[model samples]
Target: MRTFWGLMRAYWFSDRWREAWTLTIVIAVLTTLLSKAGVWLALMIGELTYSINFYHDAANTSPLRTTLTSGVLVIVLFVLKDAVIAGTRSLVSATLHRKWRGWLNSQFNEALLDGNHTHFHAQHGSADSGAAAPDNIDQRIQESIKGMTGGAIGLAMGLLGVATSLYFVGENLLQTSVEVKGLEFLGSYGSSVLALLAVATYVPINTWIAVRLGKAMERLNVRLQQAEGSYRSELTTFLRRSFHVAASRAEDVQKTMHNRLYGDIDRTWARLIVVTVGYNAFEAVHNFLGYRIIAYAPGLVSFIHNKLDLKGYVTGAEMINQLIGQCSWLIHVMPDIATLRANSQRVTELANAIENVQQPQEFYSQSGRSDFHYASQNPVFGLTIQKLELAHQGEDATPFLSAANLRFRRGEWTFLRGESGCGKTSLIKAINGLWPYGRGTIVFPDGVKSFYAAQEVKLPQVSLKQLVCLPGSEQDYGDAQVASALHKAGLGDFIEHMADESREGKIWDQMLSGGQKQKLVVARIVLQQPGLLFLDEATGALDPDGKIAFHQAIKDNCPDVTVISIMHEAVAPRSASGDEFYHSVVAIADGVATKKPLVPNLPRELTTILTQPRPVEDKWMRFSRRLKQK
Candidate 1:
């Protein structure tokens, strides 16, 4: 319930809180009125029955006038009651989808994207297993959140209305005395009191048993949701990597993986079925016991026939059944409550994981660095790396780099040159506050907007202009600005397709080639015009000439942009003519970063030479590496 409230309180008190409260009050008042109206309609049936009985008597022949009037009124009340029910259903449903569920969907969706469309904390599980995002956030947003609103809010309000209506309708149950054959003292008590006593005793036991069975179902539902999410996630993965699977001819391997995923769902679903059957069987027997217990009270039939009129007896019977239904509400919805708990728990788990990921903690016992705190007021150096170490993310992994220092002067384009698997991306992420595995400070300049263009470019299904201007409103940037950015990034051919918005899934993804996708992202960075930009091998898909043009375009358009390009040495190479076109290089090797003057950085050779730091004559004696003959 604590976890349940964590999800509710967010949207309940959100910006639409005023609308939320208004709708809540409207539903409550309408529900209460509807319940009262239902009670009135039930009583009107009794009055109608009395009128028919009155007309049946030969002594009172008024041409059935009173009976006809009563019948007409009963029909009107029935129609009105049903109409109100239909209207209320529409009203609540509209509010649920548009106001409550809609708002919640957008809220959690934004959270899932982490406001960057990055889905960093969402797709990647948190460091702590307990605080990780639950599998299949799509399932949470689509189905579970809907269930949460309906079950948590709608069910609660509905139960409240039922309870309120019972207070008035229960008056009919007092018309007769409940007398047990063996216990004649029961006759001294009104039927309502006896009914209440019976309910007070029996309901607790039934509810206790229902709850016990419900608990197992609750745990089962959580497992079921997880398995379903896992299965769905596999399908999504298969689709995303469909091209690779086809090209590599790994269909059999993928089929086996998919089989394993669905097999989990199948096993969990089987368990759920077993539990559901048992629960239903118990419910059937328990509900029968509860309903019959009051109906078969000793001497109740005699009391009804001898002491009450036809109307009184009929109304009493109806009210007694209604009372049972009202009292058994919790028992009836136990399965729903269990499912609701499971959905809300998954939502809360994702919420907790995102919260934890956003918090600044000890990345190492030594601590990790983020760009948030270490902002320098000076403009001379746009960004500074203060003794930052690089480490991969895992328990078995240790920092590969020793504390390394460097500075990026304002408007400088510095190449982050390193060998493959040399933690260049990790260093960039550490400096940009994305990585949480290394220690030291990243001195980000104050009031400087930053953009990171990753190696893999994904174009969302939207207009080319919108894609370029995304993470920012398309309204913010003019079409000309977007078109110019595209032209600058070697995507001049796409300018004609600026207005082409593909609403169909991944159409734009299919339309654009690999090089075009990379350029599209580059255009996005250029269109945004951030003061600081990190390009993590973003030009990998482009040819040598295209790469040269890509770099030149950024320099030309965003002249003062401080660019840190993490260059893969194999891809970028060591010549100015090709991808190695940067003037400065920060080469990371030998677990340290060195500020080298040119491309073809000689740090690896320098470190090798420095390790032989013995006197020339006794070098062989001091270090085994410098053996005389060898």
Candidate 2:
């Protein structure tokens, strides 16, 4: 309960608090007013029924006139009541859904992106470390947000309606007394007593059943979401890799996995439906029996009989009985309330997970030294790691990287080489402050801009121009500049085709090959020209010549940029006629990084090229040289 309220406070006090609060208050006030009006209308209709049945002929007013007037009023009241409810519900629900989703999505995304990326992924794999992180996070973000918003609105309105209904209806039933002259049991208090008795008997039973059903449903809902998410995730994977699957002739294997996942979903859904149907059916029968008990109570019947005998009508007792029968409606809505609670629990769980992910924790210390500190000085340009050891959270026994000390000078190219699983990428993560499970002081030159291009490229589904100028506006670079960079990265043909089609906005990933994607990443580096760039197998997809061209372009185009690349093999500067592109090589073995100079052996021609001074040419001079050669 505390956690639930905390989640509510977190949302309500978020950046959009004013708008959220205003909408909530307006919806609550409107719902309360409409509910009270509805109760009043119901009570008035009951009184009118009694009058028409028992006192119509005795009154001076004509029976037909009174009946017609009351009928019209009833119709108007019902129509107005329903209209108010529908309009308020639609307006409130739509507004809240949009606002709440936007806020929640932003918060979740910020937490995921801005926090420790390595820690986040580690938690997903290890339950002990990050037990609070939700599974199928994509589904949780999408579906849970919808459920939380809609369920919260419905639960609030339903409770308000129930409260108002009880207040008005219960008061009417309690005030109207009934007496039987010949009966010694339950005289004037019969209606009130029976109403209270029925409620007292049924509420606990209804609540117990509702709670049990709610728990079962919550468990099933979790499983159902997991199954659905798994199926969708697998489907996306298969579609993305359809060509590969076909070429490998593993269609049968993929199809079998798909069928098995879908079967799990189908079976889970069937069980959920069966349980839901059974619960509803049972509730219906339970409500009928509860209502019948009050309606046919001996006290109620005796009072009605005596009233009919004395006054030639039993309108008072009949009205009271009708009001008492309304108690069953509360019982009927118990399941909905339970479902709401379950949904709230799910939302609370997600909120907690997000909170856990975003909260800061003390950094893990491996060197047992706290003497290292970073000073905030001007013009930061390099990276320094001292005694840094990183391990996955809660896995101190097996360190990903251990006691590694390294320094990268400004404007120098360094290559990182290691066998598979030797923590080359993990070192990059540690340097970027995305891996928190390391004790070391990594001091970056103040105000240094760094960019990392991963092995598997993730191109957004946007225009080619947007993809190239990502994290920056396309307007920052003119089309001609973009075209020049693409050409440098060996995408001149792509630009020509795009120019013919007037490619204002188009997704290029589908049309591009693996080599092209790597080249595109290189194009991004060329365009952005950050102070420090980390490339993890960024050119692995490209052929040797293509790799050489990209490396030469980076060195030529952005001479001042520092490059740290992780690769399976060394990136030789042979393309530059052995003019030593990399200043040093850092090799990782058994969790330690040892720095070494470039390979000693080289061709005499390559060695001579390294000794020669190369002339630097501007872009225009290079262009003029190319024209002359042509």
Candidate 3:
């Protein structure tokens, strides 16, 4: 509840606050005026009928002018109030609906940004594959917000009006009954009975049913969301990989997605049927007795005793009419109010999941190499490798990376090597500040900017030029500059052909061969030009020839750039060219890293030179001293 309030307060205090409140007040005033006009009009007509009946029976006192005038006045008031109410509701609904939609969308986008959309996916699972489905969160928020907010606010106002009217109407009925007879009804005891019955009967049962329904809806929502995701995946494949899906005969995939959606809806409909039927039965039987039969009972008994005429009975019925109408509104509003409460609770939970939950302790930026730090303001220790950890289900230790410590200074490449499941990717993510599950520090130059290219790339709907430019960037690049970079990465031909075509959903990540995609990833590295580059399987997709060419391109293009690559191959070839090429190779195995010999296999000449130690003249051996200085 507190979480929901925090989210709601952000909007309630926004610039739209005055407008929303004003609309709310206008709608409330109009609804109240119409309801009172309806009751008064009914009473006025009853008075006119009683006056005519008296004139006919007594045959002396004529009240034709008074009766006609009162009847006309009541009708005019009714028409005017009803017209204003209609206009007010239409205007308020139009403005409020749009405002609600815009607010919800903005909130959702902000939540995504603040929460780190990438982090949420990494922790919860992919947006497509997570146990808690995010696919339909947007849809659910959109469809539910307007109805929930408007209905909830309206019901609240209606409830307030009902309470106020009940108090005053009970007082008026008591005074009228005292004037007409000795019977003492419509007093403290009567009002208490009615209020007690409302609370005891409607509140608890309706609340329980509403909560249960919300849980069912939430489950159904998850299934429907999964089905939608599956359908979208198939659709994307059909559009981009038409030949592949067709050749593979993926009709079964399409059919299965459709069947799942239908099945979910079918089950939901059955549950809804039961819920609606129960609600209808309760509303009908309760309103029939409370509003119609019981309300008129007092007036009917008075008429039989001759203590009240038809006029008095009609006037009493008018007061009863107000109470009955209000009660009917309450009955109709119960289920929706419950649903709104449930939805509000969900919104709170989502807000808490993103914002309030404490994260694992991370390494402070101060404890890193002063010269090699990446955008931190202070310095403490060089190679500040702090505690490394990962979060799993419910506080159990699932160590993606454990007490790992390895650091390299400027002017060297430290290759992290590990067998499968050694947390290579996890290590890179931790260094990049994407993995908060681990607690550790990776000290580097304070102002250095780092760019990472993961194994799987995300390609947005944009031109090849804009794709390299990065999303939301305004830095424009000319065709010549883009072409040059593409040519260096062996994609110049593809760019020229695709320049004029829309590349939206072109499957750049999936359609391109593994090598081509790797080249593109490297091309982005060149284009973005970060000082420190962390490549996780950045070269896995590249062939040997492509890998060598791309590596050389990076060395030639960005000599001052520091690169820490994860490699499985021997470091001898990379180091053999010069001391600058490979001075350091840190091998990470079984969740630990150590400076070790480069793996076996080098070109025969280089191998012979490295194998046969020549005094202390070896460049790599001499360079070890240089590393120790930093």
The weakest ten consecutive residues by lDDT in model 3 span 362-371
lDDT of 2 by residue, 34-77 (tens): 76666556655754675567554665367776667777787777
The TM-score of candidate 2 is: 0.82
Better of 2 and 3 by TM-score: 2
| Candidate 1 lDDT tens digits, 124-158 | 55444444445677787787878777778756665
Off by over 4 Å in 2: 47-61, 115-125, 130-132, 180-190, 290-299, 308-342, 359-381, 390-404, 436-438, 475-483, 492-506, 570-573, 576-578, 599-601, 604-630
Q: By lDDT, who's the top model here?
A: 1
CA lDDT of 508 in candidate 1?
A: 80
Worst 10 residues of 1 by lDDT: 363-372
What clash count does candidate 1 reach? 0
Model 3 RMSD, rounded to 1 decimal: 8.4
Best by TM-score: 1
Q: Could you tell me how far off, in angstroms, the CA of residue 217 lies in candidate 1 after the best superposition?
A: 1.9
